[model samples]
Target: MFAWFKRKFAKSEAAPAQQERHFMRNRTGARMFAAARQDRLGTAWGGTPLTADEIVDRNQVVLVARSREQSANNDYGRSFLRMCRQNIVGPKGVMLQAQSMTARGKLDNAANQAIEDSWLEWGKRQNCDVTGRRSWRAIQNNCITSAAKDGEFMVRLVFGADGGPWGFALQVLDPQRCPIDLNDQRPRTGAFIRQGIEFNRYGRPLAYYFTTTDESEAGYHWGGKSYVRIPAEEIIHGFLEDMVGQKRGLPWMATALFRMRQLGAMEEAAIIKARTGANQMGFIEWDDGFGPETKEKDDEELTIESEPGEWRVLPSGARVKESNPQYPTGEYAPFYKQALRGMAAGFGVLYNNLASDLEGVNFSSIRQGTLDEREHWKDLQEWLIESLIEPVFEAWLPRALLAGLIKVKGKPLPAERLDQYRVVEWQARRWQWIDPRADVNSAVEAKNNMLTSPGKLIREQGQDPQTVWQESARDVAAMIEAYKSEGIDEATAKELVLLSMGRPQPKVAPTGGNTNEAA
Candidate 1:
């Protein structure tokens, strides 16, 4: 029996070796793909193909917690939050333009003005947000920051009695209210819950299952089941979807979280070392326990206090060795910059912007980096407009119209033409020129060549083009009147008004000779 068992064990041990050899022999094209080979280098590399929902369900909570902690404590993390808020939402939030038109294809200025004016009023802190504390800009700031830190932002719409005068209000909820692992077999209908989101046969979110009580509240348990079903239409969930079937968002800084933590710990250690070195003058060593023979306690007898410009004579057989500590070595700055560069790349931002270190960057490099970073910010801004702004406006407009809040000349707007009034154009915040002269020259070239328009240029500067045109016309008329009153001719007054408005004058050449224009 012992011999049989020994033979069986040997066979079992040899089987894996034999199988590995066989597998290697069949892999003739293994060199084509280094990663596919089961070689020594690839032994420790392993992965599993998980669905998007499964992966999100498994990692969302942990990633969000770590991201929040980092953003709260780490400088780079906080910088990222600030950058998102400022660049994506800006000081003034995204502006709205109503594009309602008459049947003759002309702009219905009356309806548009009424809608715009009412929207501006409704966007106030006491009217727009359910909590009555966050204005339109603040809500946008929170949405962007929350999405950057937690990977998603959730807002619930309150209407009728629960809302403000316009019968519309927004309630921002913590992403934690919707549990990540709350998968349940939702009754009757073929829908089911995955990561607190209920999906139908087509994977469309039908409803969200949110816990009524927060985890921080008293008597809260992980397994306790108290969920409120909110329909998908009523909830505005904003997240960056990386995959087609992704149900949840992964934090924007998830990839760099580990590096940020490690870098923070390293910086702390370096600071402590430098501080310790700066404070310690030297160390006193006593020869083999032969120290001062004072009546004080043994521990206190060896304790020597020294002050500036003072010298102390040590006891017999004692020697002082000056101490020197070299901390934050030459490699530290390079390592730190390289790590931050990697993190910045992960966060889709410029290293200079992320680290606020513009030491060696010139105009060209800084301009390129700023352009790339602006593109990233623009992408997020577009996402926010589509995911949150448009939907909220669509929902709010109908409620405001029905409640007789939206009016034209003290008369209520017709609710029958809701579709016409719903057409809106959002003007997002734009960056200022880095080199004003160069930028202006390029813009002039573009305008002269018909590559751009006045409206486009005005919009790029974060101003409404139509409003600018009206203001310009009004200012020019006023200027012309003022100039005419000063005994100037009508045509020259118009010309002076144009010149004052920064319009270039038409240069007339002399009779025959070629006119040379000064640059």
Candidate 2:
């Protein structure tokens, strides 16, 4: 039975190793490929295939319309087409143009005018949807006149349905005369030489290709005879949406997870410290009221009163039947009644006296000093953690562990066990001291110990202890200094020190010298 139990435990231990090997062999390759693709495409490349929603989220469509006041050209048309193709479809997508230009002739003037008029009408109809207007003749006229005289024109329109402005289309009118070099290798023609109206099926004035001539020569014309058609289709549905969604969500998720884990760790640490009798001190307001004191009335003084019917004669002159009357002293009057009346008469004098003391004691001014001190301490702590401790551990520990030179026994050492690791003692009149005798030592001693330890018996021959100590110490000091600057507490500093000490050290090179020479 014992043998079976041992075998079961052994199998369980080996499971992770087997799983790791499988993950390295199978998942690594795919993940690497995806990462590379993402880098190339400027998008997320998770191993899993992209979804439609992701594509849509990533898509960014931008429609850039220029008025006729702006110069028009064939390049605009070409750019529009290129933008659409790259964004809407992958590079392999196809593009098609519906041709609508006829050969120019003397009798074709009226026909040309009719075609132009028809195109303009179509533009007007579509303008409401595309340009948010009823008319855009001025803008279209620039492209048309330029196309007619220059024999080419182009404009830009961006599609942001996918991860980018994906889809694009270029409308080249009078293809026979106004052919555009798709490669952009040729010079653009003059604006007056090319003139022809171009539009998206949706009525957006994509561009206008036209050529202008003297009234004697002819106006621009468009017909079946002067144009050729190309047809193509490409699809990258929801690509943009997916890209945007992933880009926005993944980093946020990563950051949130990291922060939550960090906060949880801190909470755990705080709980453990509290259990172990660690006292955390903070300031609390002491409200021992120091305002004015009130006193109660003592005994009332006796008063003698004389009734209307009986008059009291002077004791020495006239004597009647002996009777005593009490006279009131009025000692039970409300406290501060006279003082309040006096104050009301001369309130400005009291105000001036109080104002002198409170001249500089506004709300903001009162708290500024305390706020500044708190901020300074906070900044110091941040510097210590981020600049000092984090860098050294992140940089050094992994290498050490990978080399079989260090080990972490638990996720976080218990607060009670902390003293067993290191002691950071602060003196009233001197700098802090970190004791080296505990489990945690200075970077130098730790490195030297690691180099000469049993794990590197084969690698050790004539290593320099002093050099190792110096290097290690420098590294450790850098980390400690950073933490100190950031305002990390003594306990955290000690933990960081231990963590640093546990990092791996490289084997020292041999040096030729006297046998008794100190490293």
Candidate 3:
């Protein structure tokens, strides 16, 4: 029985070896031509021998430094930034709302008001925006636009005596000055590992390396020790991450390079063809001409050099022929539109938004596209609020309160409770209804059924409900006062308000006529 078991085990092992030999043969016949015929050739994608660091280095130098990446801001990249502004920042940029949850169900209106007023005052100060050129809205637009164009933006906090415990100013940095190479000058605990960002073993960033001056400045050293180390706490980095463990930012225009460049070349060629083709070229007869074809046998071959804005003079008896390619510019539109559509996909924006083209787009199609695009914008807004805005507010809150620059309920807030007041809400960009009639009806029905709330709808519109209600109340009071001044009653004024809001008044029966006749 033992001998029989050994034989069975040996046969089982042999069967696997035989199956392995068969399995080793390529089962998928769709491999590339070169790998299919060769026994040793492997797939090209996985065959790359470089490590992650090497790959990043190559991408930094070769891809990030490309001319297209630099010019992207003035080129097609504008559309991407425009979308970011329209969907993320809107006209007002990001708005802050301080809601104190420490008060339990009841809002700490005084505390919230104090925090908001102080922050607003601090932001409105001259040079509050470190650049000294931008207002709050302008700086918000600048930071977002910079991140989109350059793939990353770094904001430095300059704290000093402008107001509060310490007045703070924000300065956005150029990514070019931030080096991505490792320096041996730091400790060996991986605390200063990786490019511009230095991280500890736990992978938390500690510092950043930045150059002393912009390279474009006059008398700037092209070759020198121009780097300075900045602590991570003083900086806010804004970037849309595309890969895990990616140390640097990459522009949204990176993937669209191939298509953008090709379209540019094609259109440039078309322009040349159109403009040059319009010029008439003539061949002169031998009567008394200098045309190459009309030159005498004894005379050297003659040529009329055509310079821009220079007329080509011809003798009598000359025959002119149109050398136009006759290719219509409209032919390039479809190709451009198709390429633009693909590029828009890479940008994560709708083609209609980027191209501003509504051709062939129905309500359902546009709505679907807008819904997906809005979701992505919302995600971006959340990231910005969480990563950039929240941290800044937290850093600013304690300092402002301790400096006695801000007061809660007309008294200085306790420093211990600073953390409690730090909890705040940021309103992101919102959209108006595409079809207000239907959407408003739906919203009304949902509200009546307790499926949604006014606050939720107000937030969806990128507004603070309290603010909206206050404004509306003020408007209603003003309307009543104006109607009273004109000898109209409060009820009539309120009815007018309803009528203005698209709620029509019911028809009344005539006083002395039949009800049927009135109807």
TM-score of each: 0.88, 0.15, 0.79
Count clashing residue pairs in model 1. Answer: 0
Candidate 3 lDDT at 336 equals: 81
lDDT per residue (tens digit) for residues 330-392 in model 1: 989999999999999999999999999999889999999999899999998899999999999
Give the number of the best model, judged by TM-score. 1
Using TM-score as the measure, name the better of candidate 2 and candidate 3. 3
Ordered list by TM-score, greatest first: 1, 3, 2
Question: Which model is ahead, 1 or 2, in terms of TM-score?
Answer: 1
The residue-by-residue lDDT of candidate 2 on 173-254, one tens digit each, is: 2222322211111134311211122334332333433232112424434342343222111110110112432211111011
Error of model 1, residue 282, in angstroms: 1.3
On TM-score, the stronger of 1 and 3 is 1
Q: Among all windows of ten consecutive residues in candidate 1, which has the lowest summed lDDT?
A: 213-222
CA lDDT for candidate 3: 0.73
The segments of candidate 1 whose C-alpha lies over 4 angstroms from its true place after superposition are 1-28, 39-44, 186-188, 213-221, 286-316, 486-489, 503-519
